[model samples]
Target: MKKLAFIGLGNMGMPMARNLVQAGYYVYGLNRSKGKEKTFQELGGQAAESLSYIAENADVIMTCLPQPADVEQMLTGEEGLLQMNIKAPLIIDFSTVSPSLHTAIETKATEKGARYLDAPISGGTAGAEAGTLAIMCGGKKEVFEEAKPLFDVLGANITHAGPAGSGTKVKLINQYMVGMHTAAVGEALHLADQSGIDQSLVYSVLSNSFAQSKIFDRHYNDFISEDKDEPGFALELLLKDLGLAGEMAKESNASLKAGDLVRDLFENADTNGYGKKDMSVLYQYVKQQED
Candidate 1:
Protein backbone atom coordinates (compact mmCIF):
# COMPACT_ATOMS: atom_id res chain seq x y z
CA MET A 1 0.00 0.00 0.00
CA LYS A 2 1.46 3.35 -1.02
CA LYS A 3 1.35 6.45 1.15
CA LEU A 4 -0.55 9.00 -0.91
CA ALA A 5 -0.44 12.74 -0.30
CA PHE A 6 -3.46 14.40 -1.87
CA ILE A 7 -3.30 18.16 -2.25
CA GLY A 8 -6.04 20.75 -2.79
CA LEU A 9 -9.07 19.89 -0.71
CA GLY A 10 -11.55 22.05 -2.53
CA ASN A 11 -14.93 20.96 -3.97
CA MET A 12 -13.37 18.43 -6.37
CA GLY A 13 -10.28 17.40 -4.49
CA MET A 14 -11.90 16.70 -1.11
CA PRO A 15 -14.19 13.98 -2.41
CA MET A 16 -11.39 12.46 -4.52
CA ALA A 17 -8.96 12.26 -1.62
CA ARG A 18 -11.73 10.77 0.51
CA ASN A 19 -12.36 8.17 -2.22
CA LEU A 20 -8.70 7.13 -2.13
CA VAL A 21 -8.90 6.74 1.62
CA GLN A 22 -11.99 4.58 1.25
CA ALA A 23 -10.10 2.54 -1.34
CA GLY A 24 -7.57 1.63 1.37
CA TYR A 25 -4.66 3.88 0.51
CA TYR A 26 -2.68 5.29 3.43
CA VAL A 27 -3.47 8.85 2.44
CA TYR A 28 -2.43 12.22 3.87
CA GLY A 29 -4.56 15.24 3.11
CA LEU A 30 -2.33 18.27 2.39
CA ASN A 31 -4.57 21.32 2.42
CA ARG A 32 -2.96 24.74 2.77
CA SER A 33 -6.35 26.19 3.63
CA LYS A 34 -6.63 25.72 7.37
CA GLY A 35 -10.42 25.65 7.31
CA LYS A 36 -10.38 22.52 5.16
CA GLU A 37 -7.78 21.00 7.46
CA LYS A 38 -10.29 20.63 10.31
CA THR A 39 -12.99 19.19 8.06
CA PHE A 40 -10.61 16.55 6.70
CA GLN A 41 -9.32 15.81 10.17
CA GLU A 42 -12.88 15.30 11.40
CA LEU A 43 -13.16 12.64 8.76
CA GLY A 44 -10.09 10.90 10.22
CA GLY A 45 -7.37 12.11 7.83
CA GLN A 46 -4.04 13.50 9.00
CA ALA A 47 -2.77 16.87 7.76
CA ALA A 48 0.93 17.28 7.16
CA GLU A 49 2.82 20.23 8.64
CA SER A 50 3.71 21.74 5.30
CA LEU A 51 4.08 21.11 1.57
CA SER A 52 7.67 20.04 2.14
CA TYR A 53 6.46 17.65 4.79
CA ILE A 54 4.12 15.94 2.33
CA ALA A 55 6.84 15.94 -0.32
CA GLU A 56 9.15 14.11 2.05
CA ASN A 57 6.55 11.62 3.27
CA ALA A 58 4.29 10.75 0.37
CA ASP A 59 5.12 7.84 -1.88
CA VAL A 60 2.37 8.67 -4.35
CA ILE A 61 1.50 12.38 -4.68
CA MET A 62 -1.59 13.70 -6.42
CA THR A 63 -2.71 17.31 -6.70
CA CYS A 64 -6.01 18.81 -7.81
CA LEU A 65 -4.96 22.46 -7.92
CA PRO A 66 -6.64 25.24 -9.94
CA GLN A 67 -3.88 26.46 -12.27
CA PRO A 68 -0.55 25.77 -13.92
CA ALA A 69 1.30 28.31 -11.78
CA ASP A 70 0.08 26.58 -8.63
CA VAL A 71 1.18 23.26 -10.07
CA GLU A 72 4.64 24.74 -10.77
CA GLN A 73 4.84 26.12 -7.25
CA MET A 74 3.92 22.74 -5.81
CA LEU A 75 6.54 20.98 -7.92
CA THR A 76 9.40 23.54 -7.86
CA GLY A 77 8.82 26.17 -5.22
CA GLU A 78 10.71 26.30 -1.90
CA GLU A 79 8.23 23.90 -0.35
CA GLY A 80 7.87 22.14 -3.72
CA LEU A 81 8.25 18.56 -4.82
CA LEU A 82 11.63 19.25 -6.48
CA GLN A 83 13.02 20.44 -3.16
CA MET A 84 12.15 17.23 -1.38
CA ASN A 85 14.65 14.38 -1.04
CA ILE A 86 12.87 11.44 -2.48
CA LYS A 87 13.60 8.65 -4.95
CA ALA A 88 10.94 8.42 -7.63
CA PRO A 89 7.49 8.89 -6.12
CA LEU A 90 4.75 8.93 -8.72
CA ILE A 91 3.21 12.41 -8.84
CA ILE A 92 -0.23 12.80 -10.35
CA ASP A 93 -1.41 16.31 -11.20
CA PHE A 94 -5.15 16.48 -11.71
CA SER A 95 -5.26 20.16 -12.57
CA THR A 96 -6.71 21.53 -15.82
CA VAL A 97 -3.74 23.28 -17.41
CA SER A 98 -1.58 23.64 -20.50
CA PRO A 99 0.25 20.70 -22.06
CA SER A 100 3.45 22.73 -21.93
CA LEU A 101 3.16 22.97 -18.15
CA HIS A 102 2.61 19.24 -18.06
CA THR A 103 5.80 18.68 -20.06
CA ALA A 104 7.73 21.16 -17.94
CA ILE A 105 6.66 19.46 -14.70
CA GLU A 106 7.63 16.06 -16.05
CA THR A 107 11.13 17.37 -16.78
CA LYS A 108 11.44 18.73 -13.26
CA ALA A 109 10.20 15.46 -11.76
CA THR A 110 12.75 13.57 -13.85
CA GLU A 111 15.58 15.57 -12.29
CA LYS A 112 14.55 14.13 -8.92
CA GLY A 113 14.21 10.60 -10.37
CA ALA A 114 10.44 10.94 -9.90
CA ARG A 115 7.58 10.53 -12.39
CA TYR A 116 4.55 12.71 -13.17
CA LEU A 117 1.16 12.15 -14.72
CA ASP A 118 -1.04 14.90 -16.15
CA ALA A 119 -4.66 13.92 -15.57
CA PRO A 120 -7.30 16.57 -16.05
CA ILE A 121 -10.82 15.43 -15.22
CA SER A 122 -14.38 16.01 -16.45
CA GLY A 123 -17.92 15.02 -15.24
CA GLY A 124 -18.22 17.94 -12.78
CA THR A 125 -18.63 18.01 -8.97
CA ALA A 126 -21.54 15.58 -8.99
CA GLY A 127 -19.19 13.19 -10.73
CA ALA A 128 -16.44 13.99 -8.29
CA GLU A 129 -18.72 13.29 -5.33
CA ALA A 130 -19.84 10.03 -6.91
CA GLY A 131 -16.37 9.13 -8.20
CA THR A 132 -17.65 8.96 -11.76
CA LEU A 133 -15.39 11.44 -13.51
CA ALA A 134 -13.95 11.07 -17.00
CA ILE A 135 -10.18 11.23 -16.58
CA MET A 136 -8.00 12.00 -19.59
CA CYS A 137 -4.39 11.25 -18.79
CA GLY A 138 -0.94 11.66 -20.38
CA GLY A 139 2.32 10.09 -19.24
CA LYS A 140 4.51 7.10 -20.04
CA LYS A 141 2.61 3.97 -21.00
CA GLU A 142 3.83 2.11 -17.95
CA VAL A 143 3.05 4.99 -15.66
CA PHE A 144 -0.40 5.40 -17.15
CA GLU A 145 -1.09 1.71 -16.83
CA GLU A 146 -0.03 1.78 -13.19
CA ALA A 147 -2.25 4.76 -12.49
CA LYS A 148 -5.28 3.58 -14.50
CA PRO A 149 -6.77 1.41 -11.76
CA LEU A 150 -6.61 4.23 -9.22
CA PHE A 151 -8.09 6.58 -11.78
CA ASP A 152 -10.82 4.04 -12.44
CA VAL A 153 -11.70 4.20 -8.76
CA LEU A 154 -12.20 7.94 -9.16
CA GLY A 155 -13.75 8.09 -12.65
CA ALA A 156 -15.91 6.05 -15.00
CA ASN A 157 -13.71 6.55 -18.08
CA ILE A 158 -9.93 6.70 -17.85
CA THR A 159 -8.01 6.96 -21.10
CA HIS A 160 -4.29 7.17 -21.78
CA ALA A 161 -3.96 9.61 -24.68
CA GLY A 162 -0.12 9.67 -25.03
CA PRO A 163 3.03 11.12 -23.45
CA ALA A 164 3.12 13.93 -20.90
CA GLY A 165 0.95 16.97 -21.82
CA SER A 166 -1.41 15.13 -24.17
CA GLY A 167 -4.09 14.76 -21.49
CA THR A 168 -4.24 18.54 -21.05
CA LYS A 169 -4.44 18.81 -24.85
CA VAL A 170 -7.42 16.46 -24.95
CA LYS A 171 -9.04 18.20 -21.96
CA LEU A 172 -8.77 21.55 -23.77
CA ILE A 173 -10.84 20.07 -26.59
CA ASN A 174 -13.38 18.63 -24.13
CA GLN A 175 -13.77 21.96 -22.29
CA TYR A 176 -14.29 23.86 -25.54
CA MET A 177 -17.20 21.65 -26.44
CA VAL A 178 -18.70 21.80 -22.95
CA GLY A 179 -18.44 25.59 -22.97
CA MET A 180 -20.27 25.82 -26.30
CA HIS A 181 -22.93 23.37 -25.22
CA THR A 182 -23.53 25.21 -21.94
CA ALA A 183 -23.96 28.56 -23.70
CA ALA A 184 -26.28 26.95 -26.24
CA VAL A 185 -28.35 25.42 -23.46
CA GLY A 186 -28.70 28.82 -21.82
CA GLU A 187 -29.69 30.57 -25.04
CA ALA A 188 -32.12 27.91 -26.23
CA LEU A 189 -33.91 27.62 -22.90
CA HIS A 190 -34.25 31.39 -22.76
CA LEU A 191 -35.84 31.54 -26.22
CA ALA A 192 -38.10 28.57 -25.44
CA ASP A 193 -39.43 30.20 -22.25
CA GLN A 194 -40.17 33.45 -24.07
CA SER A 195 -42.38 31.69 -26.67
CA GLY A 196 -45.48 31.78 -24.39
CA ILE A 197 -44.85 28.12 -23.61
CA ASP A 198 -44.77 26.65 -20.12
CA GLN A 199 -41.16 26.29 -18.95
CA SER A 200 -41.77 22.63 -17.96
CA LEU A 201 -43.38 21.88 -21.31
CA VAL A 202 -40.43 23.39 -23.15
CA TYR A 203 -37.92 21.63 -20.95
CA SER A 204 -39.62 18.26 -21.51
CA VAL A 205 -39.90 18.69 -25.29
CA LEU A 206 -36.32 19.72 -25.76
CA SER A 207 -35.06 17.03 -23.40
CA ASN A 208 -36.73 14.25 -25.42
CA SER A 209 -36.07 15.67 -28.86
CA PHE A 210 -32.81 15.73 -30.83
CA ALA A 211 -32.05 19.01 -29.06
CA GLN A 212 -31.32 17.17 -25.81
CA SER A 213 -27.94 16.70 -24.14
CA LYS A 214 -26.44 15.88 -20.76
CA ILE A 215 -26.68 19.57 -20.00
CA PHE A 216 -30.40 19.52 -20.85
CA ASP A 217 -31.06 16.42 -18.80
CA ARG A 218 -29.17 17.82 -15.86
CA HIS A 219 -30.02 21.50 -15.91
CA TYR A 220 -32.84 22.44 -18.32
CA ASN A 221 -35.24 20.27 -16.36
CA ASP A 222 -33.71 21.30 -13.05
CA PHE A 223 -34.00 24.91 -14.00
CA ILE A 224 -37.68 24.60 -14.92
CA SER A 225 -38.69 22.21 -12.16
CA GLU A 226 -36.76 23.33 -9.10
CA ASP A 227 -34.67 26.33 -10.04
CA LYS A 228 -31.82 24.36 -8.57
CA ASP A 229 -28.46 26.03 -9.14
CA GLU A 230 -26.17 24.12 -6.83
CA PRO A 231 -22.53 23.98 -7.89
CA GLY A 232 -22.07 20.73 -9.71
CA PHE A 233 -19.49 22.81 -11.54
CA ALA A 234 -18.97 26.48 -10.90
CA LEU A 235 -19.48 29.13 -13.61
CA GLU A 236 -16.32 31.00 -12.69
CA LEU A 237 -14.21 27.84 -12.89
CA LEU A 238 -15.68 27.00 -16.28
CA LEU A 239 -14.79 30.49 -17.42
CA LYS A 240 -11.25 29.93 -16.20
CA ASP A 241 -10.99 26.59 -18.00
CA LEU A 242 -12.50 28.09 -21.15
CA GLY A 243 -10.00 30.90 -20.98
CA LEU A 244 -7.24 28.30 -20.71
CA ALA A 245 -8.74 26.43 -23.65
CA GLY A 246 -8.59 29.56 -25.80
CA GLU A 247 -5.01 30.08 -24.76
CA MET A 248 -4.15 26.46 -25.50
CA ALA A 249 -5.82 26.68 -28.92
CA LYS A 250 -3.90 29.82 -29.83
CA GLU A 251 -0.63 28.20 -28.81
CA SER A 252 -1.39 25.25 -31.07
CA ASN A 253 -2.37 27.52 -33.98
CA ALA A 254 -5.81 26.01 -33.85
CA SER A 255 -8.91 28.15 -34.28
CA LEU A 256 -11.60 28.01 -31.60
CA LYS A 257 -13.90 30.94 -32.22
CA ALA A 258 -16.74 28.96 -30.69
CA GLY A 259 -14.64 28.58 -27.58
CA ASP A 260 -13.81 32.28 -27.71
CA LEU A 261 -17.50 33.18 -28.06
CA VAL A 262 -18.54 31.10 -25.08
CA ARG A 263 -15.62 32.41 -23.10
CA ASP A 264 -17.27 35.83 -23.29
CA LEU A 265 -20.61 34.36 -22.23
CA PHE A 266 -19.04 32.90 -19.11
CA GLU A 267 -16.98 36.02 -18.50
CA ASN A 268 -20.17 38.09 -18.61
CA ALA A 269 -21.76 35.74 -16.09
CA ASP A 270 -18.76 36.11 -13.79
CA THR A 271 -18.83 39.88 -14.08
CA ASN A 272 -22.55 39.88 -13.29
CA GLY A 273 -22.08 37.93 -10.01
CA TYR A 274 -22.95 34.47 -11.32
CA GLY A 275 -19.39 33.34 -10.70
CA LYS A 276 -20.28 31.43 -7.55
CA LYS A 277 -23.24 29.64 -9.11
CA ASP A 278 -23.17 26.25 -10.81
CA MET A 279 -21.89 26.32 -14.39
CA SER A 280 -25.35 25.29 -15.60
CA VAL A 281 -26.76 28.36 -13.86
CA LEU A 282 -25.67 30.43 -16.85
CA TYR A 283 -29.39 30.26 -17.58
CA GLN A 284 -29.61 33.15 -15.12
CA TYR A 285 -28.07 35.32 -17.79
CA VAL A 286 -31.08 34.57 -19.97
CA LYS A 287 -33.51 34.69 -17.03
CA GLN A 288 -32.26 38.13 -16.12
CA GLN A 289 -32.90 39.26 -19.68
CA GLU A 290 -36.46 38.00 -19.34
CA ASP A 291 -36.97 39.86 -16.08
Candidate 2:
Protein backbone atom coordinates (compact mmCIF):
# COMPACT_ATOMS: atom_id res chain seq x y z
CA MET A 1 0.00 0.00 0.00
CA LYS A 2 1.28 3.44 -0.93
CA LYS A 3 1.53 6.14 1.71
CA LEU A 4 -1.32 8.57 1.03
CA ALA A 5 -1.78 12.19 2.14
CA PHE A 6 -5.39 13.42 2.04
CA ILE A 7 -5.76 17.18 2.25
CA GLY A 8 -8.64 19.64 2.75
CA LEU A 9 -10.77 17.40 5.00
CA GLY A 10 -13.94 19.37 4.42
CA ASN A 11 -17.48 18.06 3.84
CA MET A 12 -16.43 15.75 0.98
CA GLY A 13 -12.78 15.14 1.76
CA MET A 14 -13.30 13.98 5.37
CA PRO A 15 -15.68 11.19 4.42
CA MET A 16 -13.58 10.18 1.42
CA ALA A 17 -10.48 10.10 3.60
CA ARG A 18 -12.31 8.01 6.19
CA ASN A 19 -13.31 5.59 3.46
CA LEU A 20 -9.68 5.23 2.43
CA VAL A 21 -8.64 4.63 6.02
CA GLN A 22 -11.38 2.06 6.43
CA ALA A 23 -10.10 0.29 3.34
CA GLY A 24 -6.79 -0.27 5.22
CA TYR A 25 -4.76 2.41 3.48
CA TYR A 26 -2.52 4.38 5.81
CA VAL A 27 -3.83 7.92 5.23
CA TYR A 28 -2.17 11.10 6.49
CA GLY A 29 -5.02 13.59 6.93
CA LEU A 30 -4.14 17.29 6.55
CA ASN A 31 -6.53 20.12 7.32
CA ARG A 32 -6.19 23.80 8.21
CA SER A 33 -8.55 23.37 11.17
CA LYS A 34 -7.57 21.50 14.29
CA GLY A 35 -11.15 20.37 14.96
CA LYS A 36 -11.45 18.77 11.55
CA GLU A 37 -8.08 17.12 11.99
CA LYS A 38 -9.30 15.73 15.28
CA THR A 39 -12.40 14.38 13.57
CA PHE A 40 -10.23 12.70 10.96
CA GLN A 41 -7.96 11.38 13.67
CA GLU A 42 -10.92 9.83 15.48
CA LEU A 43 -11.65 7.95 12.28
CA GLY A 44 -8.35 6.05 12.67
CA GLY A 45 -6.33 8.24 10.31
CA GLN A 46 -3.13 9.99 11.28
CA ALA A 47 -3.12 13.80 11.27
CA ALA A 48 -0.15 15.53 9.65
CA GLU A 49 1.76 18.30 11.41
CA SER A 50 2.00 20.40 8.26
CA LEU A 51 1.68 20.31 4.48
CA SER A 52 5.44 19.76 4.23
CA TYR A 53 5.21 16.67 6.40
CA ILE A 54 2.76 14.99 4.02
CA ALA A 55 4.67 16.29 1.01
CA GLU A 56 7.80 14.67 2.35
CA ASN A 57 6.22 11.40 3.48
CA ALA A 58 3.27 10.50 1.29
CA ASP A 59 3.66 8.88 -2.10
CA VAL A 60 0.30 10.30 -3.27
CA ILE A 61 -1.41 13.55 -2.29
CA MET A 62 -5.16 14.00 -2.74
CA THR A 63 -6.79 17.41 -2.26
CA CYS A 64 -10.50 18.31 -2.12
CA LEU A 65 -10.37 22.05 -1.76
CA PRO A 66 -13.03 24.78 -2.05
CA GLN A 67 -11.48 26.96 -4.76
CA PRO A 68 -8.91 27.03 -7.54
CA ALA A 69 -6.83 29.75 -5.89
CA ASP A 70 -6.46 27.60 -2.80
CA VAL A 71 -5.33 24.69 -4.96
CA GLU A 72 -2.79 26.94 -6.71
CA GLN A 73 -1.33 28.20 -3.45
CA MET A 74 -1.13 24.70 -1.99
CA LEU A 75 0.66 23.29 -5.02
CA THR A 76 2.90 26.21 -6.03
CA GLY A 77 3.20 28.50 -3.00
CA GLU A 78 6.43 29.05 -1.09
CA GLU A 79 5.55 26.24 1.35
CA GLY A 80 3.79 24.07 -1.18
CA LEU A 81 4.03 20.72 -2.85
CA LEU A 82 6.63 21.95 -5.38
CA GLN A 83 9.01 22.94 -2.59
CA MET A 84 8.89 19.54 -0.88
CA ASN A 85 11.63 16.99 -1.38
CA ILE A 86 9.79 14.09 -2.92
CA LYS A 87 10.44 11.68 -5.75
CA ALA A 88 7.72 11.40 -8.35
CA PRO A 89 4.67 11.72 -6.09
CA LEU A 90 1.23 11.81 -7.66
CA ILE A 91 -1.06 14.76 -6.85
CA ILE A 92 -4.75 14.13 -7.42
CA ASP A 93 -6.91 17.23 -7.05
CA PHE A 94 -10.58 16.63 -6.41
CA SER A 95 -11.39 20.31 -6.37
CA THR A 96 -13.61 21.70 -9.13
CA VAL A 97 -11.29 24.24 -10.75
CA SER A 98 -10.97 25.71 -14.22
CA PRO A 99 -9.33 23.87 -17.09
CA SER A 100 -6.72 26.60 -17.54
CA LEU A 101 -5.69 26.37 -13.89
CA HIS A 102 -5.60 22.61 -14.16
CA THR A 103 -3.22 22.79 -17.12
CA ALA A 104 -0.97 25.28 -15.33
CA ILE A 105 -0.69 23.07 -12.22
CA GLU A 106 -0.11 19.94 -14.29
CA THR A 107 2.81 21.64 -16.03
CA LYS A 108 4.36 22.74 -12.74
CA ALA A 109 3.95 19.28 -11.21
CA THR A 110 5.60 17.66 -14.24
CA GLU A 111 8.57 20.01 -14.00
CA LYS A 112 9.06 18.92 -10.38
CA GLY A 113 9.00 15.19 -11.25
CA ALA A 114 5.49 14.82 -9.83
CA ARG A 115 2.27 13.85 -11.60
CA TYR A 116 -0.98 15.84 -11.32
CA LEU A 117 -4.48 14.74 -12.21
CA ASP A 118 -7.54 16.94 -12.42
CA ALA A 119 -10.06 14.53 -10.99
CA PRO A 120 -13.05 16.57 -9.86
CA ILE A 121 -15.95 14.62 -8.38
CA SER A 122 -19.74 14.73 -8.17
CA GLY A 123 -22.61 12.98 -6.28
CA GLY A 124 -22.45 15.45 -3.37
CA THR A 125 -21.91 14.90 0.37
CA ALA A 126 -24.13 11.81 0.49
CA GLY A 127 -22.13 10.20 -2.28
CA ALA A 128 -18.88 11.18 -0.64
CA GLU A 129 -19.98 9.63 2.65
CA ALA A 130 -21.13 6.51 0.83
CA GLY A 131 -18.02 6.32 -1.35
CA THR A 132 -20.13 6.24 -4.50
CA LEU A 133 -19.04 9.49 -6.14
CA ALA A 134 -18.63 9.91 -9.88
CA ILE A 135 -14.98 10.91 -10.30
CA MET A 136 -14.05 12.41 -13.67
CA CYS A 137 -10.28 12.25 -14.15
CA GLY A 138 -7.94 13.91 -16.69
CA GLY A 139 -4.27 12.94 -16.87
CA LYS A 140 -1.88 10.55 -18.55
CA LYS A 141 -3.40 7.12 -19.06
CA GLU A 142 -0.61 5.43 -17.15
CA VAL A 143 -0.95 7.72 -14.15
CA PHE A 144 -4.73 7.30 -14.22
CA GLU A 145 -4.35 3.55 -14.21
CA GLU A 146 -1.88 3.72 -11.35
CA ALA A 147 -4.36 5.82 -9.35
CA LYS A 148 -7.30 3.49 -10.00
CA PRO A 149 -6.98 1.53 -6.77
CA LEU A 150 -7.19 4.73 -4.74
CA PHE A 151 -10.03 6.05 -6.86
CA ASP A 152 -11.87 2.77 -6.36
CA VAL A 153 -11.86 3.29 -2.62
CA LEU A 154 -13.20 6.84 -3.00
CA GLY A 155 -15.65 6.61 -5.91
CA ALA A 156 -18.01 4.24 -7.69
CA ASN A 157 -18.27 5.74 -11.18
CA ILE A 158 -14.71 6.72 -12.01
CA THR A 159 -13.90 7.62 -15.61
CA HIS A 160 -10.79 8.83 -17.40
CA ALA A 161 -12.25 11.89 -19.15
CA GLY A 162 -9.18 12.55 -21.40
CA PRO A 163 -5.88 14.47 -21.19
CA ALA A 164 -5.04 17.11 -18.56
CA GLY A 165 -7.94 19.48 -17.77
CA SER A 166 -10.61 17.27 -19.33
CA GLY A 167 -11.92 16.15 -15.97
CA THR A 168 -12.53 19.78 -14.98
CA LYS A 169 -14.33 20.25 -18.31
CA VAL A 170 -16.67 17.35 -17.64
CA LYS A 171 -17.17 18.44 -14.05
CA LEU A 172 -18.14 21.93 -15.21
CA ILE A 173 -20.67 20.32 -17.52
CA ASN A 174 -21.99 18.22 -14.66
CA GLN A 175 -22.27 21.34 -12.48
CA TYR A 176 -24.18 23.11 -15.23
CA MET A 177 -26.83 20.42 -15.22
CA VAL A 178 -26.83 20.35 -11.44
CA GLY A 179 -27.52 24.08 -11.29
CA MET A 180 -30.40 23.82 -13.75
CA HIS A 181 -31.94 20.80 -12.06
CA THR A 182 -31.72 22.40 -8.64
CA ALA A 183 -33.51 25.50 -9.87
CA ALA A 184 -36.10 23.40 -11.70
CA VAL A 185 -36.91 21.42 -8.58
CA GLY A 186 -37.36 24.60 -6.59
CA GLU A 187 -39.61 26.15 -9.22
CA ALA A 188 -41.72 23.05 -9.59
CA LEU A 189 -42.22 22.77 -5.88
CA HIS A 190 -43.14 26.45 -5.64
CA LEU A 191 -45.67 26.03 -8.44
CA ALA A 192 -47.13 22.99 -6.77
CA ASP A 193 -47.58 24.91 -3.52
CA GLN A 194 -49.22 27.79 -5.30
CA SER A 195 -51.59 25.40 -7.06
CA GLY A 196 -52.80 24.04 -3.73
CA ILE A 197 -51.33 20.64 -4.62
CA ASP A 198 -50.16 18.54 -1.72
CA GLN A 199 -46.37 18.38 -1.56
CA SER A 200 -46.51 14.62 -0.95
CA LEU A 201 -48.86 14.13 -3.89
CA VAL A 202 -46.59 16.13 -6.13
CA TYR A 203 -43.60 14.13 -5.03
CA SER A 204 -45.42 10.84 -5.56
CA VAL A 205 -46.55 11.85 -9.05
CA LEU A 206 -43.16 13.18 -10.03
CA SER A 207 -41.38 10.09 -8.77
CA ASN A 208 -43.25 8.11 -11.46
CA SER A 209 -43.17 10.88 -14.05
CA PHE A 210 -40.49 11.75 -16.61
CA ALA A 211 -39.74 14.92 -14.60
CA GLN A 212 -38.10 12.93 -11.81
CA SER A 213 -34.37 13.13 -11.10
CA LYS A 214 -31.81 12.32 -8.42
CA ILE A 215 -31.85 15.98 -7.47
CA PHE A 216 -35.60 15.85 -6.96
CA ASP A 217 -35.36 12.71 -4.89
CA ARG A 218 -32.58 13.98 -2.68
CA HIS A 219 -33.76 17.55 -2.35
CA TYR A 220 -37.41 16.77 -1.69
CA ASN A 221 -37.05 13.71 0.48
CA ASP A 222 -33.86 14.35 2.43
CA PHE A 223 -34.30 18.08 2.86
CA ILE A 224 -37.49 19.89 1.81
CA SER A 225 -39.78 17.29 3.38
CA GLU A 226 -37.90 16.98 6.65
CA ASP A 227 -37.14 20.72 6.88
CA LYS A 228 -33.48 20.00 7.37
CA ASP A 229 -31.48 23.18 6.94
CA GLU A 230 -28.03 21.74 7.57
CA PRO A 231 -25.28 21.95 5.00
CA GLY A 232 -25.22 18.72 3.07
CA PHE A 233 -24.12 20.77 0.07
CA ALA A 234 -24.21 24.47 0.76
CA LEU A 235 -25.85 26.94 -1.60
CA GLU A 236 -22.70 29.07 -1.60
CA LEU A 237 -20.61 26.13 -2.74
CA LEU A 238 -23.06 25.36 -5.52
CA LEU A 239 -22.82 28.98 -6.56
CA LYS A 240 -19.04 28.57 -6.83
CA ASP A 241 -19.46 25.55 -9.08
CA LEU A 242 -21.97 27.49 -11.15
CA GLY A 243 -19.45 30.32 -11.45
CA LEU A 244 -16.87 27.80 -12.65
CA ALA A 245 -19.36 26.51 -15.21
CA GLY A 246 -19.95 30.03 -16.44
CA GLU A 247 -16.20 30.50 -16.78
CA MET A 248 -15.94 27.28 -18.76
CA ALA A 249 -18.74 28.40 -21.07
CA LYS A 250 -17.19 31.81 -21.67
CA GLU A 251 -13.79 30.25 -22.45
CA SER A 252 -15.31 27.91 -25.04
CA ASN A 253 -17.68 30.58 -26.45
CA ALA A 254 -20.62 28.35 -25.59
CA SER A 255 -24.07 29.74 -24.85
CA LEU A 256 -25.42 29.06 -21.36
CA LYS A 257 -28.83 30.64 -21.36
CA ALA A 258 -30.26 28.46 -18.62
CA GLY A 259 -26.94 28.40 -16.86
CA ASP A 260 -26.90 32.15 -16.65
CA LEU A 261 -30.47 32.29 -15.36
CA VAL A 262 -30.09 29.61 -12.70
CA ARG A 263 -26.79 31.11 -11.62
CA ASP A 264 -28.56 34.37 -10.84
CA LEU A 265 -31.12 32.56 -8.75
CA PHE A 266 -28.38 30.84 -6.77
CA GLU A 267 -26.52 34.10 -6.50
CA ASN A 268 -29.61 35.72 -5.09
CA ALA A 269 -29.99 32.95 -2.57
CA ASP A 270 -26.38 33.27 -1.53
CA THR A 271 -26.69 37.02 -1.18
CA ASN A 272 -29.92 36.73 0.79
CA GLY A 273 -28.33 34.78 3.66
CA TYR A 274 -29.17 31.25 2.51
CA GLY A 275 -25.59 30.74 1.39
CA LYS A 276 -24.59 28.63 4.37
CA LYS A 277 -27.78 26.58 4.22
CA ASP A 278 -28.15 23.28 2.39
CA MET A 279 -28.85 23.46 -1.34
CA SER A 280 -32.33 22.15 -0.63
CA VAL A 281 -32.93 25.58 0.85
CA LEU A 282 -33.44 26.73 -2.71
CA TYR A 283 -37.00 25.55 -2.33
CA GLN A 284 -37.39 27.80 0.69
CA TYR A 285 -35.83 30.68 -1.17
CA VAL A 286 -38.25 30.22 -4.02
CA LYS A 287 -41.18 29.93 -1.66
CA GLN A 288 -40.18 33.12 0.13
CA GLN A 289 -40.03 35.04 -3.12
CA GLU A 290 -43.82 34.79 -3.28
CA ASP A 291 -44.30 35.83 0.34
Model 1 regions more than 4 Å off: 221-224
The 0-to-1 C-alpha lDDT of every candidate, in the order given, reads 0.84, 0.92
Clashes of each: 0, 0
Q: Candidate 1, 259: how far from true, in Å?
A: 2.3
Q: Residue by residue across 1-291, what tens digits does model 1's lDDT show?
A: 678888999989999988887887777888768889778777667787877777778888899987678888888877777887864789999999889888988998988899889999988777888999999999999999888778988999889999999998899888887888888888877776777777678777877789878876777655535777777677887888888888887888988776777898788889989998888888878689668
Question: What's the TM-score of each model vs. the native?
Answer: 0.94, 0.98
Best TM-score among the predictions, by candidate number: 2
lDDT score at residue 136, model 2, on the 0-100 scale: 99
For candidate 2, the lDDT comes to 0.92
